[model samples]
Target: AELSRLLVLKPEILLLDEPTNHLDLPAIIWLENFLRTTKCTIILVSHDIEFLDKNITRIFDISQNTINDFKGNYSKYIIFREKEIERQIRQKKNQDRYIKQTNMLIDKFRYKKNKASFAQTLIKRLEKMEKIEIDAFDISSINFQFPPPLHCGKIIFQSKMLKKTFGENIVFHDLDLDIYNGDRIAFVGKNGCGKTTLTRIINGELECEGYFKKGEKVIINYFAQNQNELLDPNMTIIEYIESIPTEKSVSQLRGLLGSFLFSGDSIYKNIKVLSGGEKAR
Candidate 1:
């Protein structure tokens, strides 16, 4: 609604932050078209690479305490940034090698009376050379994998004539489902289409009219769509992960969080201070 209002006003300059956060597919598509054709100069901050690639003509990359402008979309910017980093790395390596060789020459000849002047010249040249500094790249990625489920019956879940309603609105009705041990399922629909509601019901987090049954030794590890909202705001990342009932020790837990790119002092940061992406992770 806020985005709709902003678009209606047709402001000369539009600034948006994570505009596709909770938008459905259709809404995201419409927004992409609108932004592509809009006359306004837009400054958008989004982690949605596809959205940015579709709508943006330029990129402003904030890194190393600087804002670097690139003259293309997200994909192009990635290519260009990588090339730039490679160039910087090469230059730094060459410069370091030169500096090292020059220092060695200076040290070897500085004590000799005949080469004192040459050593002094080398020192002066080294002092005058500009040092190359490369920006730090964080390439850490999540590495944890889900453990294999314990042995269970082939029929994992079964439901018959499942129905859900809210007041006068019937979200879904007369639905039958059977989930097998190795079956992979995806529930896709537009906003408020009961996908989440159905999942919640299956997880026993919500009441529903249904004949539902779990197979022997079945276990459900549910991650809600609004999982970030369920986080304890005052708890640190490490504290929150530790609160879960697990046999992993502090060091192992830290390694797990590190795999999720939460390293160093970031593991100690309160959940309230984390960004949306960090919270989601």
Candidate 2:
């Protein structure tokens, strides 16, 4: 409902600051889908690297009191920045030609007999000129491992001419995409570019015209933005979770709930009647 409200405002540019900070998993993904389908100019500041990479196409970086603009998604920014630093280094290496030429002219003219003070001053000025400054580049980096890929049957799914619109806003047009079992796909672009829209059309519920297809026995399950409702109004916080069948051991579940700020009798409170902070809990 909040997202639908935002969509009604007809903004040409959107600014998001840690927009996912308080969102549950489903809400986070719903935002992801919503942003993916949006075609507005968006500027986002987020600590969520995966979300940033999946959504934003440009990076504006401020470092050491200087600002740098990179015309690519976050992942490409890393690759392009490394290459750019090397290019700048090469250009600066050739700048020695300026100093060497100046020195040569000084050597040739300095010994002229009875040279004036003005000439001496000129030589001194040339010698004192500082080298152009181009600072060395530094890029912070981290490496992590992902879960092993699960194999799916070939011809995973297909969609024909999916469509979406919000009043006058048209999110997609005649879109077609096919997924295969072994494909490891990464959607790259700025936020609100339809990555999430396509996900919705594939799963059904989002409106579409042309036929969509999927290989046999494909399973689809998503925790949409409304997963917060799972907190349950009628049940106590602990009772809400206890009602669900979970594979987690009891100790692990308690630890997880504690992380979300529910512990002891606090979990025993009826969530439907809980305060905002407690529901957030």
Q: For each candidate, give its TM-score against the true structure.
A: 0.93, 0.40
* lDDT tens digits, residue span 178-253, model 1: 9999999998778899888989887878888879888899999988768999999999999999999999999999
Q: Report the lDDT tens digits of candidate 2 across residue range 32-146.
A: 8888898888888886889989898889876667778888788888788778777777776776776677667667667876654545766787678766666444443333333
Top candidate when judged by lDDT against the true structure: 1
Runs with alpha carbons beyond 4 Å of true place in candidate 1: none
CA lDDT of every candidate: 0.90, 0.71
TM-score of 2: 0.40
- Candidate 2 lDDT for residue 120: 74
Off by over 4 Å in 2: 1-5, 97-101, 104-108, 113-132, 135-281
* Candidate 1 Cα RMSD (Å): 1.7
